[model samples]
Target: MVATKGGDRVSGMIVETEAYRGPEDRASHAYGGRRTRRTETMYGIGGTAYVYFVYGMYYQFNVVTAVPEVPHAVLIRALQPVEGVELMRACRPGRPDVSLANGPGKLCTALAIDRSLDRADLLGDRVWIERGDRPVSAASIARGSRIGIAYAGEWARKPWRFWLKGNPFVSRRDGMPRHVRAGRKAGGGA
Candidate 1:
């Protein structure tokens, strides 16, 4: 859940995530230990928000996940709208609730997240993560290669993307196999 100063509140259950490890991971903004104004927040203490603008348009939101000085974070790839559906629809006019936040940029747009909230504390009132009811078991989670980063070379093939298997709210389902969607091995499916 995140609340903007304008009093707009959006809440959702995170259904997809992508992990990036700093310095060593080519897919990370902090790769090679590069420290820039934009990536500084990623090196901060865990629980900080690392929001950045991409392609001169969309803002991507990430949660700093490592202790201070170690840049590890998870990109919020997709979310299941739980509250503020109308507000989300307003932000993404014409989009159905299921597709409103089914991607990183869409998630930000739906929740009104932007560079203004970069470095904000995730435990603060303005933007925070609240515990939600357990919606899926760990075994139901599926791992896959991160998306849209083929330029990262071999690093792009790493299975760092995690999402709830069979969740319609996940960003993309094209590559997931039917058995995985069914929460079973290929041969185990009835």
Candidate 2:
């Protein structure tokens, strides 16, 4: 519930999210309401974490938002992890104490988020994006293929992904190296 210069937690948590429509939204794991116990949270409003397990190892994080009951959300591909950082680290221990809140998987890991958080409101204190006043420009935002799932075909190519032009804590994809890549490589649906 602590708000920061970059809007509170979830505000920035949701600062950049990809809107994956129904099943047609090829990139959406919940496309077609593929309710499989893991994606059930996608059906709710914007404010909760839509967490799911992948590769039997990593945990992908998302923010559930939109009209209640309407399945939609913005995938939280990455984060700055300003709030509750020690707690975040408790959830994700690194090989050398590196940030565990940068990548989509790391975000969830750092936050200790899993499917159990599904349907939990973002407006609540346990988890939420505390929106900021400033607006991140679309021009400053970059577009590129979402990470790890290039095999999604056209879904893989759709550049619904987004992020601040340059923030050291944000995640990096194959298209761009964290420090050397020019411009930003957009991400996929939230």
lDDT of 1 by residue, 46-140 (tens): 99899999988999999999999999999999999988888889999999888999999999999889998899998787789878786577898
What stretches of model 2 exceed 4 Å from their correct place?
1-17, 94-98, 173-190
Q: After superposition, how far is residue 78 of candidate 1 from its true place, in Å?
A: 0.5
For residue 70, model 2's alpha carbon misses the true position, in angstroms, by: 3.8
Candidate 2 on 1-190: residue-level lDDT in tens? Answer: 2322223242224323455665667677766668766666777666766777887888766666677667777677766655556555556665223355667667666666666666666676566565545666667676666665565678777877776666555576434734554465656324
Instruction: Give per-model CA RMSD.
Output: 5.2, 6.9
Off by over 4 Å in 1: 174-190
lDDT of 2: 0.61
Q: lDDT of each structure?
A: 0.88, 0.61
